[model samples]
Target: MTPDEISTYEETLGVLGDIDHRVVERVLREAGWSPCGAGDWAVALRAPDGRAAARISPFDLVAPYTVALYREAAHTRQVPRLFAHRRLVGGGDLQIMEWLEPVDADEAAGFHRALAAREPEVAELADVVRRVHERGRRDQPWFAPKLDDNPDNIMRNADGRLVAADLFGADGPRLYAAVVDDPHLVVTTIPEPERRFMTDIPLTNTGPWPPEVRAAMHESLTTADTTHQA
Candidate 1:
């Protein structure tokens, strides 16, 4: 990215004013967005042409370190694409990302069943988490903050594979402890009971796995390191 682009991005985020509806609109408009909906510090918007979805936030600056870590994760594809990160002109941080489509009830149910079955899907998720951790370790060597690792952060794409999202955290590593540590996990963000079942085993952990899962996790970390190095 050019210095000018970076400067403009930062300026736009800095203009958010006070993290309210008015500020959200101003920031979105400055960033070329059309308002859709909003939550507390976060606001949803569509690209000018309506070809993509985006979200703006003032919360990113609340924990700048964690936000940097998330940007690193995005670079490694350990998380979703990060379209933009900047300080609004009024005085807040903003992040724009590719809006992901919602996972359907049937698909959500299948994901739940697959996770419960402890089949290959859970293993795959474990691998993804491992990659995320590895990326965090290398990019932010002194700070290896744990991800939320909740169902809401995990989205399924057109091919029916899970992708992780949401990059903010309350603290270093235990943001969403329940989902990460639970042996029987279900992502409750989506309404469908069947699709809600994510993985039977919590994919985020320190170690001591069943050999295979552990191995995959190790590989993910190693690959992440090597890829970044290259």
Candidate 2:
């Protein structure tokens, strides 16, 4: 791999820590995703045009979980529909989902302003979150969402409907905790199911505000005794 490839591949490793590196390489080879871009949390790959994307990450449960969270998970009419997923088969998880267009720049900017302000708090987060956990299990429910409500995730097309985009991100567990920690991220509520769930599970998967989020991310990604991040 070239330096660029190595850099992106390392970001992939950052998201899939604990999994053997060789296995991840094989999975990527078989999956045949054309590389898009990657950051600290995960790597982005897409199938040929007109096909859904398949993102590989450490968060095995989030994809199916998101599918179940949204009421219209089946229809891609409004949001990106998760077509399928592989739950950590061979030490890696693959999420197959609809390819959504980028959110409108103006609309995204407006939403970002709202995020920075945490204005007009929405109470719906509790319900939405509850639904995700409820459907996240094999016997019961499903989940898709990047924890951060970065306006980039909320997109729209010609029809003016909200397009659920950028449903991939950094560490799954940390992302979850970040959402729970911030009342402004999604919705605010005193009663908490995820909080209780987090405590109940001994070993389970687990932010910061906009500008602060980046800083905190840098802090977490910082490697000791080295200027580079992991």
TM-score to native of every candidate shown: 0.43, 0.44
Least lDDT summed over 10 consecutive residues: which range in candidate 1?
190-199
State which candidate has the highest lDDT.
1
Instruction: Per model, state how many residue pairs clash.
Output: 17, 13
Residue 98, model 1, lDDT: 50
Candidate 1: count the clashes. 17
Error of 1 at 51 (Å): 3.8
lDDT of 2: 0.44
- Predicted model with the maximum TM-score: 2
- With candidate 1 superimposed using the best TM-score fit, by how many Å does residue 96's alpha carbon deviate from the native? 1.6
lDDT tens readout by residue for model 1, 112-213: 455435467455544444555555555432233554434554565434445555533433233123333421221222112221111222233432246665
